[model samples]
Target: MRAKRTPVLDRACRACGFSDSRGLTHAKLQSGETVTLCGTHELMLRRAGGAVDAGELRGVLSDRRDTVRRSVGGGDELAESLQEAFAPNRRRTERRAS
Candidate 1:
């Protein structure tokens, strides 16, 4: 019996070493070897006559937006700030040693 084959893991972007594959570009060479590129390098490649995906560009943006949204919560900042502002303040008067 033949051993099962493992899935191919993605490599870092050849241009910038970015490992996430979400916004990278890819190409298959004339020799049938494939390479990946980061967003900036991918744009350069496209402007230089290489064909890349529009979906890829949008994918990167959407992924970044979702990450930011997750980091920023839906809680009311104004309410929190107001509560903090109205809380009691304690002032300590230190007695000087005579």
Candidate 2:
């Protein structure tokens, strides 16, 4: 008989309990335990070579939030640029520019 396994996205982070489909990922530890971790914990585990504790989870989560906030603080420049390039009136100009 086989044990039932939890679905990947349905599992909570082993370190912090953060559960979002996009932010979750799986990692296999040296002990052969497969754990689902949020992006922050996964990064911490990879860098420090150990499981992140609950106390450390808070700091890591905050740092990750800040880093993501800073990186995405830029306005939607890509969307705007893409829209401008693909706008119907700009079709001829885009061809000429290319």
Candidate 3:
């Protein structure tokens, strides 16, 4: 009987900040392999035609919004600012879902 094969574990580069959960723009040290990056890094990679999975992008955006909200103490004014900054993107994402 043949044994089941285990999936290879993917790791992120701490120096370059790559991860499987995020999206990748450039090829990794190993040719033909893609590397995932955080939102901040993704934006930087955008110019290079880097793309992220919509769901992952949304999660990152939400986390960033939440971080901003918490940093501002989650007050009405802060929430309003965050909404102003992030609401448009949220709306766009929702519209794309339809």
Most accurate candidate by lDDT? 2
TM-score for each candidate, following the candidate numbering: 0.35, 0.42, 0.23
Tens digits of per-residue lDDT, candidate 3, 1-98, equal 99998544335532245575545333232233354455465564454453344343334333333353435455588778887878776667556443
Query: Whole-model Cα lDDT per candidate?
Result: 0.57, 0.66, 0.47
Better model by lDDT, 2 or 3?
2
Stretches of candidate 3 above 4 Å error?
1-31, 49-98
Clash pairs for candidate 1: none
lDDT of 3: 0.47
- What local lDDT does model 2 show for residue 89? 88
TM-score of 1: 0.35
- Weakest lDDT window of 10 consecutive positions for candidate 1: 57-66
